[model samples]
Target chain A: MIKFLESIGTNILSWIKITQGFLSLVGQTFYWIFFGFRKKRPLKQEPILDQMVFMGARSIIIVFFVTFFTGIVLAMQSAQQLSKLGGTIYVASLVSISICRELGPVLTALVIAGRIGAAITAEIGSMQVNEQIEALDTMAINPVRFLVVPKVVALFFMLPCLTVIGDLSGMLGGYIIGVNNLGINSHLYIQTAFEYLTLKDIYTGLSKSLVFALIIAFVGCYQGLNTRGGAVGVGRATTISVVTSFILIIVADCFVTGIYYFTNL
Target chain B: MREHKVAISVQNLVKFFDGRKVLDGISLEVYQGETFVIMGGSGCGKSTLLRHMTGAMKPESGKIFFGDKDLTTLNSDETEAVKRRFGMCFQSAALLDYLNVEENVSLPLREHTTLDPKIIRILVKMKLNLVGLSGFENLMPSMLSGGMKKRVGLARAISMDPEAVFYDEPTAGLDPIVCAVVDKLILDLNKKLLLTSVVVTHNMESVFRIADRVAMLHKGRVLQIGTPEEIKNSQDPIVQQFINGRLEGPINFAENIDDVNFAGEG
Candidate 1:
C-alpha cells in the first residue's frame, strides 16, 4: 500500500514537472518571437522562411487530399439520410458547415501533427543525441531561438493557411458529389454551401487551428529537446510527439467547440 | 607556457548521476596557450569534468572559473556571454546535417555578428582551409568522411577565433594516420593562434603527442598532473595501468564495464 502510494506521488510530481517544462517552453517561444530582438540573439528570418517552406508548402498536398476525401465521405453518408427526408439539397449545407466548422481544421491539424510534428521531433531529438544542440549552446546560440522559434512561428502562421486550403478542397469535394452523384444543381449547391457557412463558423475553425498549431509545435519540440538515449530515443520521441499532439489537438478542439457552442460564437 | 596565466580553473567540483558521484571532489587548471590533456580510462569522469569546465553541465556542489568569472554563479545570459569566448569540438563532430560545409563553419559568425556576408564567407573559407577543407564548401556533412567531418567540426569550432577550445575526444574513432593529422592540426592551431586548448581523451599516443601538460583522472579524481613526459613515467599503479592499456593493475575493470553499457558505447 505504501509503495503504491509512493509511486502515485512520484507520478504526480513528475507530471507537474513535465507541465512546468511545457509551459516554460511555450513562454520562451513567445518571448523569443516577440522580445528576442532586443537581446544579443535576435531572432533570424532565414530559418523561419526555410521552415515555412518545409512545414507549410510541403504539407499542402497531403492536407488537401485528407480533407477532400473526408468531404466526399461526409457528402455520401449525409445524402443517404437527407434523401429520405426529401431534403437532399441540404447536403451542401451539411458538408460545407461540417468541413469549415470541424473536419477541415481538425483533420488538417492531425495530418500536420503526423507529418511536420513527427519531423520536428525526430530532427531535434537526433540533434540532442548527437550533441549538435550542445555545440550550438557552446557557440552561444540559443537553441530555442535558433530552433523552436522558427518552427513555432512558421507552423503558427502556416497551419491556419493549410486549414484554409483544407477547407476549400473539402467544399470542392462536396460540390463534386452533390452536383454529379446526387444530381443536385451546381449553382444551387454552391449557393446553399455559402448561405449557411457564417463568418463565425469559418473564424471558429481558424481559431481552433491556431490553438492546434501551438499544441503541435510545442509538443513536438518539447519531446525532441528532452530526448535521450540516442537513435532509439529519437524514434521514441517522434512517436510520442505525434501521439501526444493528436490527443491534444482533439482535446483542444473539443474545448474550443464547447466554448463556441455555449457562448453562441 | 605563456606565463602560466590560467584560462580555466575548477575547484572541488562534485556532481552526482542518479545518486552516484559521477564527478567527485575534483579540481584542475588549464593554462593559457597550452594543450592540456585530461586522460582517463572509460567512466573516470574525464568527459563529465570537461562538460563542467565547458559550462555544459553544472556541478551539484562546486565552482568553475573561466579566467576570473565564476561559471556556476552566472545566469543563463551571462553564461552565454562567457561561452561566446570559447569553442567546443564534440566527439561525433556534431555538424548540423541540414547545412552545407560553408554554412556550418559560418554558423557562429552569422549568429553572433552582423558581419558582411562576403566577409563571413572569407572567414569560413579561411577556417576550413586551416583544417585543410577549403573548396569543399558546398558538400553536406553526409558527403564527408569521418576524418573530414571532424576537420569541418574543427573549422566550425575555431571560426570565431575563440580564446579557448575544449575538445571532447578529438580523435576517438580515427585511423592512426588521421589521428596524427588531427594531433598536428591541434599543435599547429595552438602554436599559430596561441589558443588555449583543453583536451579530454583516452588515446595515449594523441595525449602524449599533443599535451603540453597532462592530468590523469581515475575514478573521478585526479591521479596525477604533470608534463606528458612525467605522466609517461608516473609511478602510480593506476596511472601506469591506464597509460599502458593493461587489463590487470590497480584499476578495476568491473566498475567501468557498467559505464560502457550505461553510455551505450561499445
Candidate 2:
C-alpha cells in the first residue's frame, strides 16, 4: 500500500538524519581535540586522567575475567576435536591464536561497551536532562571540549591497553587448561602457544580495539547529548547506547577482519 | 523616572515546535539596571522566549539584539563572546552536581581568565557571600536545601559579574518565605551590582515584589506589557485570569494541558 511505502520512506529519512547527527557529533569531538585549545583554552589534564583511570584501570579485572573464561572454553572445545586427529597438543596453538586474533579484542570491547559505555551515556544523559549541558553552553563552555574529549581520548588509548591485558589473561587461561586438564606438557604448551601466534595476531587485535573504542565513545556520547525527558530518558539512552555499541563493535570486527583476509595480511 | 537604555530587544520572534506555533511574533525589551519579569501560565512560551534571549535556542524568524549585537547572525566564537556578557539561572538550579560550591562558582573564572588561583578563590568567596552562602563553599550541591541550592545557583550566575542575569522561574518550588527571600535577593542584586535582570515566572507575589516592568504572555503572544501596578489593573481578560490565578476566563485549562504534553514532544 501507499501508506506502507510512506512509512518506510519516513524511517529511511529518520535513519539518514540520525547518521548525519552522529557524524557531526564525532566531527565536533575531533575538532575540539585537535584545534579547540589553540583558539580558546587548553583542556585541563585532570579530567582526562580521571577518565583514563575509570575507563582503563578499573576495567582491567572485568576484561581479564571475560577473556580468560573465553580462552578456557575455546581450548576445551578445540581439544575434543584435535584429540581425534592425535594432535591434542594443538590445543595450545588454537587457543592462543584465536584468543589474540578475535576473542581477546572482541570480548574486551563487548564488556567495555556494556560497562563504561553505559556509564558514559548515563552521566551525560543526566546532565542533559538536568540542563547542566545548557548551563555550560550559556556560560560559553563547549560541552564537547569539556566532556566528550576527555572520554574519547581516554578510551582511544585505554581500550588497546585493556586489550593487551585481555590478551595476556586469555593466554594464561589457555596455558592452565592445556597443561593441567589436557595433559599437555607445561613447557611444550608455552612454546606451542607462542610458535603459531605471530605478531600479526596481536597487532590486529589491538588495532581492532582502537576502532572499537571510537565506536563506543561516539555512540555513548551521541545518545547522551541527545537525551530528553528525565530519569526515564537517561535509562533509555544508556540502553540504546549499549545496544548500538554492541552491534557496531561486531560489525566493525567483521569489516576489519575482512580487510585483513582480503588483503592477505 | 530617568530615561532608561535598552539592554535586550526581541523583534517579532517566531518559533515552531512539531508544526505548532510555540512562539509567534513575540516582541519585548528589557531595560538596563532594572528587573523585567515575564509572567505567564505554563507553556505560554515565556521560557522559550527567555531561551532565545540567552541564545540557547534559535528562532525561526526575527532578531534578538543584546545592546547593539544581533544574536541570530553571530558565528560560534562571536556567540560565545556575547554569552560571556550575561548569565542564566535555570529552574532546577542546574549546578554541576559533581563540583563543590566554591569550585562551581569559580568555573567561569578558571575557564575564561588567566587570574591567579588565590584571586579566583577570593572572588568565589565574595560571590557566595553576596548570595549569603559564604560558609557553604565546601558543600556539594546535593548537600544544600532547595533554598540554599537556589542561592548557590544565584551565586554561580553572578560569579563573572555579568552585565545581565536571566532567571528562569527562580522561585518555582519553594516555601513562600523562601520565595520572598529570593525575590529580595533579586532586588538587592539589581541595586547592588547594577545588573540588568530578566525574570520569567508565573508567581504573582514575586512579580509584584521585584519587577520594574511586567510582560504577560498568553499562548505564545504578549498579552500585555506594563509596570506591576498596571499589570495588576490590566483590562485584558487573559491577563486578569493569570494575575488573579483564576480557573475561568479567556484562558482554557484543558487546551494548555494539551500544549504542555505537545511541548514535551519537541
Give the Cα-based TM-score of candidate 2 against the true structure.
Answer: 0.98
What TM-score did chain B of candidate 2 earn? 0.98
Q: Candidate 1 — which pairs collide?
A: none
Q: Chain A structural similarity (TM-score) per candidate?
A: 0.98, 0.97
Per-prediction count of colliding residue pairs?
Answer: 0, 0
Candidate 2 residue-wise lDDT, B191-253, digit = tens: 999999999999999999999999999889998999999998889988888889889888787
Write one digit per residue (lDDT tens) for candidate 1, span B18-102. 7778787998888888999998887778888988988889999988999899999999989988998998999999999999999
Give TM-scores for every candidate, taking all chains together and pairing residue i with residue i.
Answer: 0.98, 0.98
Could you tell me how far off, in angstroms, the CA of residue A222 lies in candidate 2 after the best superposition? Answer: 0.3
DockQ numbers for every candidate?
A: 0.92, 0.92
lDDT of 1: 0.92
lDDT for position A75 in model 1: 97
Q: What local lDDT does model 2 show for residue B91?
A: 91
Stretches of model 1 off by over 4 angstroms after superposition: B1-3, B261-266
